[model samples]
Structures are given as structure tokens and as C-alpha cells.
Target chain A: MSQHAQDYTPSEREEHQAMHLLPVRRADLPFLISLALIAAVYIVLIVGILAAKVFYVELPLIGEVFTNPGYRYAVMLSLISCSVTTILSLWIAVPAAYLMTRVRFPGKRLVDAILDIPIVLPPLVIGLGLLMLFQTPPGAWIQQYVRFTYAIPGLILAQFMVSCAFATRSMMASFAEINPRQEQVAVTLGCSRSQAFWMVVLPEARRGMIPAATIAWARAMGEFGPVLVFAGTTRMRTEVMPTTIFLELQVGNLGMATAVAVVMLITSLVILVLMRVAGRGMRMM
Target chain B: MIEFQDVSIQLGSFALEHVQLHIPTGTYAVLMGRTGCGKTTLLEAACGLRPLQAGRIALMGRDVTDLPPGQRGVGLVPQDGALFTTMTVADHLGFALRVRKRPRKEILARVEELADWLGIRYLLPRKPHGLSGGERQRVAIGRAMAGHPDVLCLDEPFSALDEETHADMIALLRRVQRDTSVTVLHITHNRNEAQALGDHVHVLKDGVLERQDPKLWKK
Candidate 1:
């Protein structure tokens, strides 16, 4: 019955205050904590580099780096190697992931456990392992036929071994998210297994491909330790964008080193944005 | 026609033990059971979606126990319709014909005919996410029939619809039977649905099937 602005019914005032308190009360603490932890990781690894770039990066030096023959060769190798690595990784991962998700086999759990090795192992250890493999008798036979160590091919191979795991993991997640019932229905409606796969299952898994390929490409772009050990940091030979930074830092040109680093950061961001956009477009279609 | 004799299959904790079933041609049969009673398992075994552990399956008088599902000439409309979310309704209807590599003109014409018959021509371009429960089921039925399969197996197809929609779908099935002679094995838990739609009804309990309501649906 009170008409004063502050004199309100309990129900009406509570409803008004509830709007303000609801978010604070119902906030998903665990999810926010999980997201914040992941965000903290990105901020530390990525933002630290960007912050370093703010002091060391001079816009005019970009042209100097671009014009240098060594830098140009590094950039070209990075582009070419990452592209090949991404393609090879996807080619290997797609079918492997399909099997991992759809098939039931005796050693499947072991095989799945093995896939995480490259992902979890230290980068230098992978390079060292590749080096040891090349030194073995069977590896020697292949080396005679196709020399990889200390060569451009070695650079690609090292990147491939490391980045392929990321590709496979993402693709496995993609394939796992899809329900097998759709393909089963397709089969009963007269589609052979392969037909069902290519028509129904593959199309459904297309969204997964974007993330798989993007993450692999970014990983390949930043690969340093494996390339340094297995491929060697030879100028105009196995040099890539990451090696360019190492070479610059060797001479104490920290500004020039961070400039190359800044370029990689920009490249990685652009790549992720493109993949997300492509994924959204495919979903809409 | 579909037949399963001495069929034994297991999936996780569920099993179909020595199950025997027969659906004669041109009949709309309902297989009724409580939820998780393995009714869908039996249906899937006949369709070759699940391998039978120890028995024979025959489809349209052919011994297809060891054959692949596509080779068995079965058209399945699974629970929730299972329509490909990415495809249009027209794509769903034309899927079988496309898989068989029918000529484009023939496939399009057949799709149009089915779309008209199922009253989903206007919804053909829409994706599954936009359709109502009844609309999705209609598209699914059309899709299943597109292959001209000898047997059409629907697993709880109408269980998701409202009462009005359920009745409408039942009437649609009757019309579909008038138009085509496909043998249908529909799985459901509802006694009322069995009474309304079945020409021959079978009750499944503990992985065993028994013919029910002899006086009501003698055929």
C-alpha cells in the first residue's frame, strides 16, 4: 500500500535484488577456474612474448628482416615446411582417427596410449630419438636411399613427427563427437561402408579437420628444438622462422630476434582466426 | 520379409539369446517391450547392424546372415530419426537412391514424389535442426522407403511425438502401406501404439518374443 520509492513490498524488492545477485550466486566457479587456468597459460607463454616484442620490436626493422636473404630463406622454409607437415599430418591422422574412434580391437588401448608419446615427450628428446633412428642399420638403408638428417627434408620430418600427434589428437576428438548411428542408418539405406564414410561420416567430421590442421600448422611453424638437433640450424638450408630468432639472439640482436618472434605470433593468431571462421562457415552450411 | 532364427547377439551388458522372429511381406508388425528389453537389439541383429553370435538371418528369402547391412536390403529409421544434421530434408529422402548411383533425374523425381507423398515437400530444403518431431519422422520414413527395401525397420519412431502428432504419423503409415508393399517391423513400448498400428504384434520379454492378441490381429 506504501507509495514511497524506498517503501516496496518484499516480493517486488527481492525480485529486483535477485536480478543483481543471481549471477554472483549461480556463477560456475569450477568452469571459470578451469578456463582461467588455461587463459593464464596462454597469457604467460604468448603474452610474455608480445610484451617482450613491445620493447624490442621496431616497425622499421620488419623491412630489414624481410629483405635479408637469410631471413627470407627462413620465412620461406617455415611456410613450405609447415604446409607440407600439415598435409601429411592430416593424411596420416584422418583414417587413423576414424579407426581409433569406430573400431574395437585387442591392442587399441595400447595404440591409443602410444599416440600421446610425441605430444608428451620433450622436444629435444624427439629430435634425439629421430637422430638415433637414422643411425641404426634399417635407418641407414633408408638414409642411403633418401638422405634426411641435416637436410631440408629432415626439417620437415622432424616437424611432422611432433606436429602429427596434435593433429591426430584433435581429429580423434572430432571423430569421437560424431554419433555412429548416422552411418549405421546410411548403411541400411543402401550405402556401403566406404560410401557411408565418404558421404555421411566424412562430411560430419569436416569441422574437426579445421582445428586439426590449424593446430598442426601452428605447431610446425614454431618448432625449434627438433629442427636444431635433427635438421641442424644451417642457414639457407634447414633454417625456419624459429631458427631465425635463435640465430639473431646468438649475435645478441634481441630486437631483431623478437621481431621475428612477433611475426610468428601474428601468423599464429591469423591462422587460428581463419580456422575458426572456416569451421563456423561449414557449420552454417 | 525378414526372418531371424536362433540368433544370438551381445552388446555390452545386453544380449539377444536364441531369438526367433518372422515378419511376413506387406505387414506392419509391432515388437513391444519395456525400455532396455533388447527390442532394438533384435531389430538391429536382423538388419546386420549387430552381428548375430550363432544364428541365421534371411531377408526377402535370401540368406543374408553373413552379408553386410547394405547388401541385406534393409532400410532403417532409428530412434530420434537419426537424420544427418548437416544434410537437407531432400538429401535425406534421396540418400539411398544416390548411394545406389541412380541417374540424377530419376533420383530428383523420386525425391519429389516421396516429398509430396510424405507432405514434406515444403520442408525439403530445411535442415533437421529446424523440423518438428513429426516432420523429422516423416522425412525419416521417406528416407527409409527411398531404397525400396524389402524390410523397413523403425525403432521407436513415433515415441517422441505428441498425441495428435502420433495419430497423424500412424495415419501416414497406413497411407504409406497403401502406396508401397514394404514389410515394416516397428519397435515400441506403448501398448496403445501396438493396438492401433500393428497388423501382427509380438511382445518381447527378457530377449524372448511371443505373438500377442491373436484375436485382434490374426494376420
Candidate 2:
């Protein structure tokens, strides 16, 4: 090799020159443009839908629909049922979460995976499955004992199944993030396992639990498919807000349906705000 | 006295096997080892946090091998202090007292005394996260000591502090041990810490305990 050429390799010299150049490559422009285009399209579609719903729809009858005694009853029933569902789900989920995080036993992975199945299953499928199961002989026997079919209990059960999965998943994550060493330390400081968890772990996990509860509650509030299939849309009986909205939409009562949707949206927003506040509190702790 | 008789535990790849030792009453013994040498595991096993696959653990002449940690009469201060993040310093100090059903005034009085002793009287109202690492460790030690345990297990308790703070804490721990007659099983990776704080030192390697020469002090 010539002395001059030996002083520096062609690759090294080229690398040196490239290092001085701005790192942005020609290939990035297309990606940036595509991302911008997708964002714009998403915003435009959302705004267009909102504009149509606000201006073109005959929504004035929504105010009268809210005043209707039957609608009010449906709303109240939905709130009460969903609240019960949320509480029931949390009651089961907190202990299940504790067991899942703190203890190691056989079939724990299987139990965890099974708990997560409802999240992946479609709501309509879950409803149909529940309906079929409850309608069968073994389920009929259960109904005789517990009254599972065409009742408020059936609606709560369906909502519980769907919402519990979400609550459990959130709570499990919360528990996992907590160092088990904290509880161990507690035990060393003269706390029983349950005492350690209740005093230390639960308080730390409370922030995550709050959001999880809110999500479950909102999910129960908007629950329609399972409630319709299992509970039967009986007006002033098993009828809930989502069921009422479904019935109204079926009968071409667009104004009432939108009003119910608006109520649900507002409720969800309030719950989300509460969850944020709880999350902030947790962070502070 | 806290005694371990050939205790062995296998947690995944790490194993603490055939570990036998004794910490006599009111002795300041330090377990020195490198990282992953099972010092923490030994402390945990002694406290009944980890189930022993073999052998036994005894505290003050009673075989507490199968006993739960709460009944073992042992206090532990973990690395990073492990202060109850949800609790104030006073609350952490009062926790064991409350569990033992001690009177409210007694608990408060003891907590106040310990807080004053540790120079954490002003930190009584603050939670663990708000305090500095040294303050948290002090609170952890105070909380453990408040219960009047048979033995105090400190696992690398001074490793989180700066050099000056580390020295101060070692001196503080020594002073407390002298005044309280509490048996301490302090664990550390640093030989200097072992020398400074330990009356008897046990060097651990791969879960095996080996006593080092008392004269072989590092620095």
C-alpha cells in the first residue's frame, strides 16, 4: 500500500466526514410526512363526526327524554347496578390481587391467565355464553338456587365478569410494582403477612386501585350486550340506561339515544378526573 | 442468642446450604460478604421470611424455625432503609407497639424518646420518601429498636449513605448497641464497615461462613 493511502483507510475517512454531517437521513422525511398525514386525518374524522352529531341531528327532544320518569328510573337503575358491580368486582379483585402478587402456589399462572380471558372475549359472546349456560339444566339448577337468568343479578354477574378482569389486571400491576421486600420488612418489624399487606402494600397500591375501580365502574355503566342478552330489556324492571338507549335507537329515537350517550360520556369524564386525582395522590405518597 | 443449625434454602440459582452460626446475646456481630453472597437471605431465613428447607433457627433458647417473623422477636433494617412509605416516622415506630397491643401513651412516649435519641425528632411528621436516605435508615433502626427485639438484623444498612454519613451512622449504631444491650447481626460488603462496627466478623462466600482473623483489618 502507498504511504499516503496507508495513513488512513477509505472507510475511516468516509466515517469521519459522515460524523460531521447532520444525522438526519433522507429516509426519515417520508416517515415524518406519513405520521403528520395520519394525525390530521384522525382529527378531521373526529371533528366531522362531532359536527354532524351536534348540528344535523334532531337532538332537541334529548332534554324532554331526560325528564321522562321511565328514563330517569332506567338511569337510576343503571347507576345502582353498576355501582354494585364495581364494588363486588373490587371486593374479589383486591384479595385476588394480593394472592396473585404475594403468594406463590400451583396453578397460579393458569388462574391469572383465566382471569384475563374476559378482557379478550367479545361482550356479546360473553353474554351469549352466560345466557346459554344459565338456560341449561345445571345452570337451571343454579337458577333455582340463585335466580341467575332474566334478573338484575344476571346483569350484575355479566358486568362483574367483564369489569373484574380490568380491575384485577390493573390491581395486579399495582401490586407487582410494590417491592415484596417492603412486606418482608414489615414482618420483621412484627407485622403478620396480612397486616403488612393491609398497612403497607394496600396503601401504596391504592392509587392504581382507584383508577382500576373507576374503569370498572365506567365499563359497567356502559355495559349493553351482556345486560340485554342475560337480563332481558324489560322496561322499568331490568331496564338500564344502556339498554334504554339501545331500545330507543332500535325504535328510531335518535335524540334519546344521543342524550343517553351524552350522559355516559359526562359520567366517564368525571370518573377519569377522579382517577387522575387519585393517581396524583399516589405519586405524592 | 440467635442460633442457626445447618439451615439451607435454595431459591432458583442461589443457594444457602449448611449454614450454621450463633449470635450470642448483646453481641454486635457483622456478616461481611460480596454481592450475591446470600447475606440478605441469611438474615431473611433467621427472621422466618424465607422457609428453611433443612435445619433449624432458635431465638433465646426457643426453636423458632417454623415460627412466623412476627413471633420470632427479631428486628430487621433492610438496605434502602425499607421505611413504610405510607407511614410517618412516628407511625413506623409505633407499628410494632400497636401490633403488640401496647398502650397509646407508652407507644407515643417510646417513639418520642427514640426519635429524640436518633436526632429525628423533627422528622416525626414526615413520611419515608420525604426524608434523606440517612434519616430513613435512622428511623428504620429506631422503629426496629422500639419493639425491644431479642436481635436486630441490619442488612447493609449503611451502604446507601455518603462516606461521612456512613461513618456517622456506624458510630450512631455502635452507641445505640452499647446503651441498649441489643444483639445486632449487621451485614455488609465492606471490610472497613465490618471492622468499624463489628465485635466479631464472619466473612461469607457463596453462602458459606468463614471467620476472618481479627487483626486483618482493611485500612
Candidate 3:
């Protein structure tokens, strides 16, 4: 036996055997390095962009984002809308995603593809579709009652239209990851379908809710084209962070635009971090 | 009593056609088959988890073909235990009682009784994530039997246990059936399991189920 082989303790020998079973060849080094280098390039670019925003932007302008009433209203609107949208998205997404994952109905494939339309379709098209929908007789009828065109409600509708799709996708993957047998066992234990969902499926899928909400909130915060087209960028009225950035840029206030973008980046990062921490906490339980 | 009258089920490329099975009241019946011979499919169909293409399922002499799983009065212990990850062992034991809206005192008494019967009184406070394979299966059995259904179905519950644990589980199940006198339909490919626990044995081969002597476990 080789010296290394002779030196290995029982645990070490087992690990060594495992390592040998899935041996990596030295010739694969260049291929592995190339794959890692490609990944690093994307990582570097993301960090580089974020760093540029933090470094190049003035602090006073960012301070104005909090102090200025127009920006303040926009920030408050963005926070409120994103929060509302996240809640609304989950309300729809959880049940819809669960159904999509569990049920097999006619036109299920078509329904699945249609559900993904907002995710795959350009944001502008979603806004345009909303825009065109409100012009139809049914849309006009609903508009007469609620008024969604170029209004605060329009902002939420546009965000929900797109954000709910993402939330649903996340939830669908979550439900799919859970074993159907759990729900079956619950049913056999005298739980009705809805009761099984509430008791067995929902609790297991709870950890997944954080990421779904995070994704929905992040997508809603970053939403630009849909909000712009569906809800006009009216300052202090229908303005949000994304629209604020657009309005600032249109007026050639580069500092203000960068500041708003930075604020958004920070908020999204905080949410992402909180979500990851909460997910970890749930798993620990 | 549990009966499958001319049951037919199709899942993707795999199918079980015109399958008939019956387990008499208070008897332990084990169904043996090859790995992909639709053992679980049959179990699921009996539990009303799967939609039957043809035939009726009766539990306690009631036709459960049109009934949903929850209304079928059946209890299931799946292969993996499929315990609720978020619930404690006490919660799992009390789950069916809670679902049926039984009195809280009654649930507590029953949960304690089941925990004691399964030799898992110490595990009642813990979750399934920290359990051993034998413990999880015991919890699954407790959860199923907690419901006090007309029939209980166990699908390969002992397939993942160590030898000692397997033997313990076999003895525990035998004792459980003896004590409760609940009708049971257990599925296993292991001939030893069938021989050990089966009061009646049925083998599924080439889409057909045929009764065999419980003592005869020939190929």
C-alpha cells in the first residue's frame, strides 16, 4: 500500500474511497477553470455596476431622495405598493400555484404556458396589454366603476399582473418539491382537500413563501416599462422609484436619478438578505 | 373490510388493468410484487389517492368509488412516512383527531395512548426531521392508526429500515393489528415481510392479482 493509503484512519479511508469513486481527471482542469472564469466575469460586472453607483453618486442628492417631498412621496408609494403587491401576489400565487402543481385538467399545458406569459413577455407588452384591455367594453365598464387607467390602482394592477406571475412560478416550484404523498396521507387522515392544503401542504411550503415574496417584491420594485405605460409618471401622484428615476433622467438630473437607483438597490439588497436569513431560520426549526 | 372490484388504473406508460383485491375484516393482507409492478399504484387506488379508470372500491362495505379520499374512511402509511415536516410527533399523532374536530381532551388522551403503544412516548415532542427510520415509520403508523379508520394501508413502510429496526417494526405491527383488530393492506416486495406478517398473501404479476397461501412464498 502507498504511504498515504497506510496513513488513513477508518473515517479518512472511507472519505478516500468516496473520492476515488468519483475521481476528477487532471485534464478537466482547463475546462473547469474556463467555466469558473465565465461565472466570475458576470459576478465582477454586477459588483462593478453596484460599486459605480455607490462611488459616483453624491451623498447630498441621495439625502434629497429622503428629504425632498416629491422623492419622499415616490419612496413611500413604492414601499406601500410593493408591500401591497407582495401580499396580493402571495394571496393569488399560493392557491393558484398549488392547483397548477397538483391538478391535472384539460388545457393544463396551455394554462401553464399562459400563466408564464407575463414572466416571458417583455414588461412593456404586459403594460400595453393592460392598456388595451381597459379600452375594451368590459375594461371600459370596469373602468367606469373603479378607474384603473393611468391611476394609483393602475400602478398596482400593472405590478400585480407581472409580479404575481413570478410569485406563482416560485410557489409552483416549491409545491412541486414537496411530496404529494404528504397531502395524500393527510387526506387519508380525514383532512379534506382544502384542509390538507392548510394543514399539511401549507406548513411544509411555508419556507418557500419568503423567496416567493422576495422575488415578487424585487420584481415589483424593478418594474419600469409596465408602470410607465400603464400608470403615467405623474410626480407625487402616480410616481414610484422606477418612474422617479425615469422622470429625473428625462429632466437631465443625473445625480438624482443615480441616487434613486442607489436607494432602490439598497432596499432590494436588505430584503434579499432578510429573506435569506428568514429562510435559514425556518429550516433550522 | 376492503375490496377492489375490477380496478383499472393508468399512470403514464405504466398500467394495472382489471385488478381485483380484497382484505377481510381484522386481517393483515400483504401484497407482493416486483419493483415496478404497480404495487404503490394499487395501494393509492385503494386509498382513493388515484382516480380509477374502472371499478369500485369499498371500505367497510361502503362503495367509496365516488368518494374523496378524506371521506373514504381509510388510513395510509406511505413508504417514506411522508410526515408533516412542520409538525411535532404529538401533532402528527393528533392530526386526524384535530381534523375531525374531536374534543381537545380526547385528542390528547389518544395521542398519548398511540405514543405509548408505538413505544415512541419520548419522541412525541420531537419532529420527524431528527428521527431515525424506525422512529419515523412508527410515527407514521401512529398517525395512521390515530384516525381509527375502517381500513389501514401500509406501502413499503419497512423497506428502508435496518435489520434490527425491521424486526422491531414487524413485531410492533403484529402487536398493533392484534390489539386493534383493524383491517390492513400492506404492500411489500420482500417475501420475508409477507411471510412474517401476512394473514393472507396476494401477488401481482403481469397486471393480475392472485391469492396465494400465506406460508407459500415461491417465485
- On TM-score, the candidate that comes out on top is 3
Per-model TM values vs. the true structure: 0.89, 0.88, 0.92
Residue A99 miss distance in model 3 (angstroms): 1.2
Model 3 DockQ vs. reference: 0.44
Better of 1 and 3 by DockQ: 3
- Candidate 1 vs candidate 2: which has greater DockQ? 1
Q: Which ten residues in a row have the lowest lDDT in candidate 2 chain A?
A: A1-10
Model 1, span B104-173: residue lDDT tens: 9999999999999999999989987657889989988999899888888989988778899998988998
lDDT agreement with native, every candidate = 0.86, 0.82, 0.89
Best by lDDT: 3
The digit string of per-residue lDDT tens for model 2 on A77-97 reads: 888888899999899888898
Of the true contacts between chains A and B, what fraction does model 1 have? 0.62
TM-score of 1: 0.89
Chain B TM-score list for all models: 0.95, 0.95, 0.96
Error of 1 at A255 (Å): 1.1
The TM-score, computed over Cα atoms with residue i paired to residue i, of candidate 3 is 0.92
**Model 3, span A13-55: residue lDDT tens:** 6876887685568998899889999999999999999999999
**Clash count, candidate 2:** 0
Q: What C-alpha RMSD does candidate 2 show over the true interface residues after superposing them? A: 17.1
CA error at residue A53 for candidate 2, angstroms: 3.6
